[model samples]
Target chain A: MPFFEAVRLALAQIRVQKLKSFFTLLGVMIGVMFLIAVVSIVQGMGNYVEDAFAGKFLGVNTFNVRRFPDFNMGDVTEAEWRAWQRRPLVTVEDAMAIRDALPAGTRWAIEDARWLAAQSPYVASGPQALVQAVTPEYFAIKNLVVTQGRAFNEQEDRLGAPVVVIGTEVAEHFFPALDPIGKELRIGGLPFRVIGVLEKQGTVFGVPLDRQVLGPFHSALHRFTGARRGLYGVVVQAPSAEAMPEVQATVRELMRRRHKLRPAQDDDFVLESSESALTTWASIKRYLVLAGIFLPAIGLVVGAMVIMNIMLVAVAERTREIGIRKSLGARRRDIMAQFLVEASTLSTFGAAIGIGLGIGLSKLVAAVSPLPASVATWSIGVAVLLGAGVGIVAGIYPAGRASRLDPVVALRAD
Target chain B: MTADAHELAGLSTTGERQAVIGATGAAPGKDWVIVTRGIRRDYDMGGEVVHALRGVDLAVRRNEYVAIMGPSGSGKSTLMNIIGCLDTPTAGEYWLNGVLVSAMKDDELARVRNREIGFVFQTFNLLPRATALHNVELPLVYAGVPAAERKRRAIEALERVQLADRMDHRPNELSGGQRQRVAIARALINNPAILLADEPTGNLDSQTSEEIMRVFEGLANSGQTVIMVTHEPDIAAHARRVVVLRDGRISSDERRDAFVSKLAATI
Candidate 1:
């Protein structure tokens, strides 16, 4: 018998028994679907983390130099902490020195102070609002938009102006009236002038940036919060995306020298990118993708076991055909090849449908839920290979049985 | 080589005891297609030994039309099964074309059976799902003949069986005699050396049986070896020779013409 005719016969048998074939493929379909779905969600979360980092850290050349490497992470001895406290705490002097010491490609640099634990006055007419204090250069680095009023200039900082930039919420809360940018309002019992209204900066964790009040560093420290603390950190902006890595390296070298680090000593400050936030997002999904790759393989192994058993039954049912083929000059290898092809087709078809459905379902999840996802191409390839491999391995025993059947006994079978 | 030598030795030992009756006078000078010696077939029926064939020696020349007659359990089917290579005897030697087939392997025997024999069963065992044309084509297909030649040969075989017009009809849609003819067509498609029939007319009515017997007689007269197993004396009388078995042993052998002359023509 020709192999082509044999294949057609097998396919016809499957078509004649649609319900059995459907159930057989269903097991593989479900396993592949879970695999692709988990891969898509992990991919989506990775993208989201990267975007969130872009939001939090705008300047590509930006690097933070502080006593501790990362925020609240590295250890500093009590003696070092006392000495650090006594040293000028990131003053404008330190900023000027570092600004002059940077390389030729270096661009704008500025510093601002922040009280780590300062509570914002939450005033709400419709929704809650928060206030943050930043230097005038904060607008330049972040390039924040002012919807309605003017931001105070260098004169305000020179004279320690008590004016503040009110956000959208501030206007909506105390004064629904128009042009309230010039109005006076006491925050924490301190009279402050509203100089400008900041626009929205999108939302994160259900809180919008337009709800925060922006102010000069001195006004936040001396007037509103009533504390005379130095600037917290400095931020720098590069000219272009191409110059980011160079500027970052220069800043690190300069910070290392300024902090007086020896050759072997580790820097007390951390230089990071939006990549860390993305990694934080990636870490949670790493386990999920890992589990997705292997967990469903356990299901696949179970499904393969069922496939092996089912194929065994199929071979037994078709023993006479096996024998007949053998008698018709079919080699043992030929019988094995035919059954292997059948098993592989079953698994590959199942994989294709499952991956297709899984990709669609992941997209649906991203649209309707917070679970963001995007299917990766490599994941699909892995799924196909896995399904085919499982089928081939599962088919071996049954194919052996079919190939080894004696033509005489098989023909004599009742 | 050692196993082959041992097989040859075993094959000679598988033949029954020496038959003194035809020991020297059996001048089988012409080519004999089949030669059996001391063929004994023992079957275990639920631990009770049933001796189906007991030292039955037989010889069939080319183009011989012979019928073996016996009651149930007289080893008629067993003898046919062994002769047709559908089975191997417990202790016996069957020489088809002078090859000791009793000790051949399964695959080797398959090649021999395909090349040497055709079988027509009384039940007309055409596949129920296949058309008459496809049923006729089955044996040729198994022989690995090319598709074009195979199709042509199958059509020719069906034409010989006078089933060309009903070639597209499945076995279920065909009459009993037509179905039997289709089966015979399938059997002839391979052009084997011998055509073996087991009660070929048992499932047909008297008229249809006679019709089938006419076909058989034509085949034998046309120089094709035809062997049949039947219990009816009249059916056996149609053959040129009749061999009888009783209690697993051959009771008598007779030339049909001489036997008919000696007995009454009641059949």
Candidate 2:
């Protein structure tokens, strides 16, 4: 028989038994639905990290030199932690040497930061804010804009000035309803004049970015932050994206020489770039993708089994029809093709519905929560192929049985 | 072209048929539509062998309308299956249109059946869900005819049985006589070498049976070879020749007039 004839026959069968067909397709539908939804969410998170989270945490084209990795994804063993602890701290001298030896047009800064409570006469106590002692160039590297008062210059940093820049949220907490500029905000039992109020910065993944205070690296805030003993990071910004790798390499070599490391020894410090953070996210995304595939696999398996069972029942019910076709000169291959086509059509239809539902679910998730979602075109293609694949695998046994039936016997069946 | 009464004057004699049937291991001539030489079929029912056909020799020429009649278990159905290419004899030589079909495999037999035989059953065995036109187009479908050609030919076949107006009706929607006519149209759609009917009127009333018999008579008169299997003597009398089976063997083979006389005498 012709291929279209077989497909038509199968479609007619499905139309005649709508309820049964729907039930048979349910498993594949749910399986593919979850598959599409999970993949969309994961894909959305990937876009979010690249566009927002990475830039919010690490400036563009900037890499931080740190004593240890700050954004580790998986668990760190006790031995690994102790080893990281034994590594030499990134001190002010090391930051100064890197700033002096780096190529021209590179922006450099030393950041010594810690979370400390603050107090003001207006409010007895305020929230613990991220207090940092940083060089003047740190403002340019971090893209911080002062909306109110002026930022301190190189002279104030060299003079160990008591002036400080406060974030909008910090201003609201310590000097509520009053002008924060020139007010005294006491930190670690020392009063510091608020020189400026920074522009409002939003949150990233539910963590606030506006609860911060910045002071000169040579000021009295260094005593509270322990900047004399060690620094949190030596941040460097390349002139262009193309110059970043060379700058990092030069800084690595200079740091190696300063630490007196041998040629065979690995670098004890870490170069933390936005790309490095994304690499960690990539590993985590891989596991999410596996889980996405695995969960849907169970649904597809159950769907396949249901389809197989339904096909078997259809074969049994149509024994007399098979005999009639055989008597009309249909070969075994014709019979096989008919059943296989029917099974695949049914499954592919289910998968299409799943794709729609999954996309809808992801959209709903994006609307109701902070997560962002965009449908991956490749996932829709995979879902379609998987639906057809499940049907073919399930149809094989039943189609084979139908094709091999003895016509003489089948013709006699009810 | 159909042979007139004068051309079919003395049909093949018993000796000539015997000579053709005795030519074992040799293909039959093109003039013979079906020839069986000692064709035997057996059924092993839980290791107990029951012989359905035991060394039956028969020869049928082109454009002949023949009937095989017997009581239940007389092996008439078995011979019909073998002649229809639906089943192969366990041991013996069988030829249809110059081909030794008894030695053919399942797929080969299917092709042969598609090209050389059309079947009408007692139950009218029309596909219940398909329209009359689609049912008639089935044999042509398996024969690999294109869709437009199949539809044209199916409509033409339905017109021959005066069922063109009823072509869109399913089997259940049509009357008994109409359904049988649809079955007849389907059987003849591919223009096979032989039209084989098994108890073609067993499920119909006497009036309906006569109605179906007229249709078959018309087909046979048009130069078509037809073989009908039945247990009714009256039904067998409609054919030009009758072969009666008893205990897996041919009890009598005679002309229609002779068969009617014998049946009348026995009654």
Number of the top candidate by lDDT?
2
Poorest lDDT segment (10 consecutive residues) of candidate 2 chain A:
A201-210
Per residue, candidate 1 scores C-alpha lDDT tens digits across A1-414 of 455655565566568878887677777888888888888887776665556445544444455544433332224578866655554345555566667766665554344422222122334224434555555766766667788887766667656787777667667666765576677755555667888888766554344556666666556434333323544466666666677677767777877777787989765555554444445556666677788877667768876877788789878887766654554344567678878877766777678888998899899988876546889999899899978888899899999888888655665554
Supply the global lDDT for candidate 1.
0.70
What DockQ does each prediction reach against the true complex?
Answer: 0.19, 0.63
The Cα error of candidate 2 at residue A234, in Å, is 2.1
With a 3 Å backbone cut-off (N, CA, C), the pairs that clash in candidate 2 are none
- Estimate, for each residue in B1-267, the C-alpha lDDT of model 2 and write its tens digit: 133552373246677688899888888887888899998999999999999999889998888899999999999989998998889999988999999999998888888878889989988888898999999999998899999999999999999999999999999999899999999999999899999999999999999999999999999889899999999889999998999999899999988888999889999
Off by over 4 Å in 2: A112-133, A143-202, A210-230, A257-262, A368-371, B1-11
Per-residue lDDT value at A46 in model 1: 66
lDDT of 2 at A145: 91
lDDT of 2 by residue, A128-227 (tens): 9889899999998888899999788899999999989999999999898999998999989889999999999876677667888999989989888987
Q: What does candidate 1's lDDT look like per residue over B115-158, in tens digits?
A: 77787877776656568888777666656788899778888998
Strongest candidate by TM-score: 2
Question: How many backbone clashes can be found in candidate 2?
Answer: 0
